[model samples]
Target chain A: MTVGLVIVSHSAAIAGGVVELAGQMASEVTIVAAGGTDDDGIGTSFTRVGAAFESADSGDGVIVLCDLGSAVLTAETAWDFLADDARSRVRIVDAPLVEGAVTAAVAANIGGDLDAVEHAAETAWIRAEESVNSGASEAEPVVPTAIDVVTASTVLVNPSGLHARPAAEFVKLAAKFRAAVTVNGTDAKSLLRIMSLGLSVGTSVHLTAEGEDAAEAIPALVALIDSGFGE
Target chain B: MALGTDWALDWLSRTAATIAVQRSHLNTLDREIGDGDHGENLDRGFTAVLTELASFDDDAVPSDVLKRTAMKLISTVGGASGPLLGTAYLKGAAAIVDLPELDGAALVAMLTAARDGVVLRGKAMVGDATMIDAWTPAVDAAARALAEGQSEAEILDAAATAAEEGALATEPIVARKGRASYLGERAIGHRDPGAQSSALLLREAANAAIA
Candidate 1:
């Protein structure tokens, strides 16, 4: 089993919505919501957060994402109350709730362990910032010509391009091989990084892979890109 | 005089009563710069602490009472103050663990530990227009009074007076932390509700010692 996630928000609707959105990309990943006060008010609840931790962790560790100041404080308080052995398995990550949950879910879907999942959640904001910066100015693609690296390019034919679903599919494919791959200068096995590239229909997709399996990883990724991700 | 479990119970009871009476006032102050829920949240926490105190046996020590209060506040406060003040009580309890009573020196150590806990939890320093603004001054005053060989009650009184002055001094500070920071220059001239509550709580501690 992969790492689990707990969304801690001040509002029940926000936690539930994030869980639903992140769940789409990671159907098998355990994502739970702990939101609102015990009285059904709009505040963080200690009981709810503690209970969510128990439900989310199924042998694999749990990553908690909180929204706003009190949510962070309450989550930390709940973390302190956890049993000593279980406490080590829980991480209260400081990241934006929505984006972090989505990226973390995809990482878990790809079979990432606790550290990998936590990094995915923590670095979600960087990818978001990169996407915003990239959106401001489109850059010309650079072709890699290194002898050891295998590279391929293809135009996306799918209507949605490399959106969430397609990005998830692409990431799952890249993770199957032993090669390290990059798509449009971003990690190919990272769903958020690929999605942050903001590839649209008819846009060119450049893939570069290195390692013993580079030759196989490049063609398979290029072929999957050519397949329009089964759109 | 050395303060014991009876004094601790008195301090908690006075704190609960004072917070209940001052709830609306604190809320009004908080509404000027923050979410306006500090009073309600604190009142709920102290109420929970009072209810939990009913279970304490007669032989319970001062640390037991403080530790129970810390847990109640942490679980029931429902705001940033929950963890901030809860950590204060928790660390204070730890400072004088198993001690049957608190002398002037023990009082200073407990206050210092409590203030340090607030600083650690909130990450706010002096003049940040937070509870630390009051707690730091109060702890400093208590430490000074203890060094001068004051009685335990007198040391608590010095802390209470310094905390009151610290809270009043917050009127001129532009908040640099918490929800109040969002107001920028507009937050100036409004006393921080957290500091004010800290002053009130410390005053209760003094009143209990004097009683």
Candidate 2:
């Protein structure tokens, strides 16, 4: 089926970036941007969704990628409005907004099914998470740690480096403790920070965790990174 | 007198059926400016709700029945309407908490609460050309009917008309929420899919209330 890709996010710039990135990976897949506004004031809405479906030659399913809960829900409502044939060909994947959109587009370009696209999107999220976590180790802490000393490390992995999913996972793990953790490469609070790290496989970096659980947190994070961010 | 559980059950069934009947038409409108899945989505959501309703006892209270329906929609429906409509039922049930029968004022309160919940969740308003387009009008109509002390049937009829009009009114406006907003000026001529389906939902509820 012609897999149609829809990216929904709070920012059109981010969605556009994802589409551009995905296009670089896979050229043949149909990718559309929904939600948010460009400087031109273009916003993704039900009208755009209908137009995308109407214009697509491939009856392949449309995979929706949303940035947040509401976007996902809006997409779901839009999806619900489709005809039987159209609905069957529609799939909504809860992927990280920008990175997930790019990954999903690339997967779709490779003629990936819904499952494959979903996996790619998830994978992208993980990669992004690791990158963010590593960056956080470089800067001041956002999540308070239990250890007294902080160490730093780099991610050395083949292929593309830390991205969304990994960064999210890393941050999630860090949030579990009382330590203040921060990612330095970009705005630590931004989800896009990890995606911007652009870490390659096998690259080395520093690791630091300080607080009561800093010792425990450091090793656990190291283990996660060592496992290729569980990719 | 306590409203029989059958009343709620019958209402749920009728609403499902009504939504099913209008699903295709909604899809057609959505196809003009949306993903073209409104028909299938609502059909699927209501179908799931129907299945869940079938499993419930006829003796169930209105709140219980509505709550279960809300939960089922939230779980089974994958998109925005699921949460929006799900919240509607959930909030409506909460509004009428422990009430066996919903009087006119109680129904108004429940619908108003449901409308508020939808607004909070979707963050869209009447002019956004969303489901709110229909829901807002329906709520207003329902309230007016209640204020006028009309019979249940008359109030429901008014609400249904208002909803239908609201849905149709979306055709000329550019969408501001969900997927259609991306189209910018291109979205101006099309009716909003969410509003269309929402009209069907309100109409169904009105019919059920009267029946």
Candidate 3:
């Protein structure tokens, strides 16, 4: 069972619109919107939140993203009413709703478990925060180490270049193996890092891996890039 | 007289009436530091609870009415007050579940649970210029009255008086929680609508007991 997502917001439009935006990145993942009140007013509803939690969970787990203070309060109150099993699997993440939901949806679509999906959503703002809060390098070079290394290079062929969807797909694949992977000197498993590269149709990126699964991961990603990520 | 369904129902009905009468005042207070929806949201919730008030049976426990009110407010209130007050009722109901009557000690415990629930949900403290500012003092007063072996009505009277002082105390403090916190120093000098409303409810509780 894949992890599901629930987006809670005071505005119904925001919740539904966020689902539509994030759904593009995670087509198969279940992203439910529990926004606004029962009357479609600009406030969170306990009934709406409780129902969303029930429907979003498919026995795996559900990650909740809330906007504003009351949204969190309503979600937490709903959580308190859930059964023990549901309570254990459900989590309310403290992060920006839109970005967190999109990244979480991508992680869920790629079959990441509960913790992985939560991490993806929670870390959604890390890059931006680091840049704003601290002047960190945009190009985070992969840490070089003395380990078994496998390398390959490929050229992108997609018309849209490595955007959010493709970058998410690439990171999804890279994170599956037990190895450190990097593309064009940045961590390959990082969706934001890979997307920030702004690689276009003509750009060539070198794929490198170091660890136990380095031998298999490098060639597989090269094949994925060579395949143009199916456009 | 035992504190039972009559007391609980009377408290809720009186609270609804008080909220309706003071609606504009609450809105005026909220307009200074918040979005000006405090009165509207609270009035809507209590009205919704009143609509379903007649459905309860005579043998129902105090928690029965309280839990029902909690669910109604949680669904109808709409905003931060929804969860904060909703949790107060929910936890308050749970605290006195299955009890046929609430004495001074039981009343103190119930108030404590309600205050704790608000604190847990809103994450606000006594000096935050939120409802907790009013609730904490009321709870503490009830606790002290119970320790002093006061009667149930006297305990509730003490709570009501302390809550009034607490709400008034919020006038000069800057808000440290909720939307009001965004106003920073501008929030000072305005009474917190939530704390004001909380004091009103505590007074209604005392009135119910006296009746």
Candidate 4:
């Protein structure tokens, strides 16, 4: 089971719409929206937030993201009411509701645990920062680690190269393994990093894997890239 | 007369009634510096608390009433006020448990705990142009009243007056906390809605004690 998510917003439509958008990429992940007040006005609700936290959780822990001030306050108050066991599993991530929800959902879809899912949501904006420094891409990828390392070279098959869906698919596969896989030296499991590489069709890149699952990770990743990620 | 459970009930009912009457006034204050929903949101919460009051036992203690009020506000009050006020009431309840009647010391303890709870929940302190500004003044006034050997009613009266003055003082300060802070220097000359509401609630508490 994936780590669940709760999106809190002052507006009902905003929260529900975010849940719908994030759900598109993660059909299996549990995402709940606790937005607006008990009367459906534009304010965060304690009851709705508490209910969302209960339903979204499936024993794998839950991460909560909120839009603004009172939303955060109410969520923290709700957290206090949670049982000790449930409290330990719930974490409040201070990130934008829309982007964070989408990022967290994709990470959860790929079997990322609570901490990884939280990181995915929190660091969703890092890709933009990397893109602005385009002059840095000419540098080499990271040197291979001392662990059991496997390396391969693969050509991009899809005419579109690597975009959202294909890149996400590649990352989902790579992240499932207990290995550190990198494409052209950037992290393969990072959706932002992988997409920021701007790999075009027929551009060959070095794929490397280290750690215990190096052999399995490199071949599976290569096959997925070769298959164009089922595009 | 001692500030007993009956006094607590009266205080809550009076506070709710006052909020219902002054809802628009609070909204106007909020509109100037904040979201303009503070009055309406607090009114809705206290109305729910009034409804929940029926569940209280006839011989309920002060702590029980305060606890239920806290829960009701937490559930009904939307926005930052919900958690802030709810935590205040919750801590207020914890401070005076098992006491059948409240004296000056007990009143001071409750107000101090309530003020601390607001700080703990909202993370706002004095000069931040938040409810804590009024609440802190009221708490310190209450403590001073107790030291001066004032009656329970006098202590509450001192707190109410200081709260009112504290709310008025917010008009010239730029907000550093809450939604009003987003306005930066523009927030000056507008009284913080939270501080105004805190003043109103304390005034009602004092009135109830005398009534």
Candidate 5:
């Protein structure tokens, strides 16, 4: 089973809205909302958090993203109440709830383990801050070694370019093998990195891979982009 | 009179009553630097605790009362206070699990655990002008009283007195945590609402001992 996510917020609508937004990019991942009080007021609920944990976890692991201070407290309380074995697999990540949930959902959607899911959630805000500080400067691209390198380039025929949905689809496909792949000089398995490129329609998409599966991965990724992401 | 389940129930009821009476004061304090629901949230939680206390079995232990209070506060109170105070009680209960009665040393242990639980959850330091300011001194004073061979009542009295002083000390210090921290220098000169409530709860604990 893939890692699941629980979004905690003082307001029910905020939590549900975050879940909906994240779910669109990762339809295969389990994302639950644990927000508001039992009476539907604006506050975090321990019972709701407890129930969310039960529903979200599928034996692999669960990651929780919370908004505000009490939301974290409520989520932690619910976590403490879990059985010892169950508690070990649950993580309460300290990150912006919305961004963290979306990235985490995409990671789980791509068959990431618990640590990979948690890492995705944790790095959401850091990457956001880096992009803001860097302004218009592009990240330095890592050139692949000469040995075992496979590469291809194609034009983006999709009308919307590589938006969140298409980026997520691309990342999911890229994560299937052992190849270290990059699309247009960025990690191909990272949804946020792909989306940040902002490659609009008619932009050139370059695919590269370095590993045993480099040959297979490069062709598959090139074909996906060539297909217009089914747009 | 031993500090047993009866004493625990009495302490909790008295705490609920005190919170109900001081609800407005707490809210006013919270409004200065927080979301202004501290008093109402605490009142709601303690009221639920009162209901839970009423259903205890005859053979129930002291920890059971604290555990139920923790659960009620965590679920009913709709703010930071809910989880903060709820964690205090939950950890306090864990400290004294299966104990039929709380002696001076047991009370010290419970208070220490409760304070540590707040520290663990809130990650606030002593001078951060949060509940830690009141709870730390109370736990320290209780431990001191127990070491001096004080009675349970006297130990609780020491804790209550120290907590009051600590709450007052929160004034004039700028907050470094919670919503008040966002205000920076503007938060000075106002007493922490959470510290005030913590002092009030400790006072209720001491009062329960005498009763």
Candidate 6:
């Protein structure tokens, strides 16, 4: 079967970027994109998705790959309207929006069936730990050194509070380490604790690291906090 | 015109239009548990398919008509549905390629091929809170009715009813695929938008086929 691939994203830029990358990787498979404008207007996403499906023919089955939840729904709806034959041929594969689209396209170019394309897309969603660990062995080992314990004071100035975007980032970084990481001023285990602390611009936080990477970890964390959590 | 042969093109045209018309309603239903764009997206995809319908002549073969529509939908629609629906058509067309008329057995073959194509594409089963909820039962019902020497209208009716019931049954399912899957328990209590729309399309096809 001659299959086409559609990549939907929250923004046209991301979708277009994926298509461009896919073109470089595989020129044989047909790839199209449907999505909202770069600024925001998510409302227009449905229309774009429809437009994408409206453009295909009966002999071609389009595989849709979407970025987020809404995109998935939009894609599903589009699939629902297909005629029996069209619906039968159409396949929605949940692949990573950007990377998955490119990989799927390449697989399709090589005459890969729907199963192979989907498999390639799913395999792309590797565990974060696996990704980090893959390169961990390549790093030079730093000598265990002692670092001074210093309290860096900083208040979250964001209107939504520190618990919003900033805390999510902190948690992500913490997950990367093997040390016993704790967010001071509340129950560190509670996501709400660090959020409720409401660390404003002048709030003080004591960051401590006590593992092999403590020397490097503490400094990096302190720098991160000093930078206002990259706000 | 022969009973089965003449009706194939009409069936495809009507089914395409039905999907386009009800696409938005499906999107609204999906909005509750899903991203709420199922109707709108399908409408857009089918609209494009409808526009391409003029390319085929009145005398085009049934498989040729289906094949063209499948290709158009796939190339135009840009999401999971595009490929799923596209593959369905391609497989169905392939199944009935040389048949001048689609008898009850031919219909079963076509449905079976379509279902296989979907399974290969989505990797979803009957209870996945996806379109398979409607498709699986509809296919089964269609096959059973056709095997029992039922008329085209009777078979289509049974298939449509089964599809509608299947779609409604998705209300309490936790989605196993797509964005709704991320919601986990939250996805429960909401009907799958894809399944709902699939029911509508099937219902319309039944009505059109009999008319």
- Chain B, model 4, TM-score against the native? 0.98
Q: Report the Cα lDDT for residue B1, model 5.
A: 44
All models: lDDT? Answer: 0.90, 0.69, 0.89, 0.89, 0.90, 0.67
Model 2 lDDT tens row, A1-231: 547787766456776787776665455778876645222232234444555555542776777777755566656655655788888877777566766766666556556676766676777676567766764555433443333766656564535556655654555465555644444433322334455656567767565555676667767767777777645
Residue runs of model 6 more than 4 Å from their true location after superposition: A1-10, A15-127, A130-231, B1-5
- Using lDDT as the measure, name the better of candidate 4 and candidate 5: 5
Candidate 3 C-alpha lDDT tens digits along B73-152: 99899989988998999999999999999988789889999999999899898899999989999999999988998889
DockQ for all models: 0.64, 0.08, 0.79, 0.78, 0.72, 0.15
TM-score for the A chain of candidate 3:
0.90
**DockQ of predicted model 1:** 0.64
Model 1 per-residue lDDT at B76: 85
Pitting candidate 1 against candidate 3, the one with the higher lDDT is 1
Minimum summed lDDT over a 10-residue window in model 4 chain A is located at A130-139
Count the clashes in each prediction.
Answer: 0, 89, 0, 0, 0, 59
iRMS per model in Å = 1.1, 9.6, 0.8, 0.7, 1.0, 7.3
Per-residue lDDT for B20 in model 3? 96
What lDDT does candidate 3 reach at residue A180? Answer: 88
The local distance difference test score of model 2 is 0.69
Using DockQ as the yardstick, the better of models 2 and 4 is 4
The model with the greater TM-score, 2 or 5, is 5
- The number of clashing residue pairs in model 2 is 89
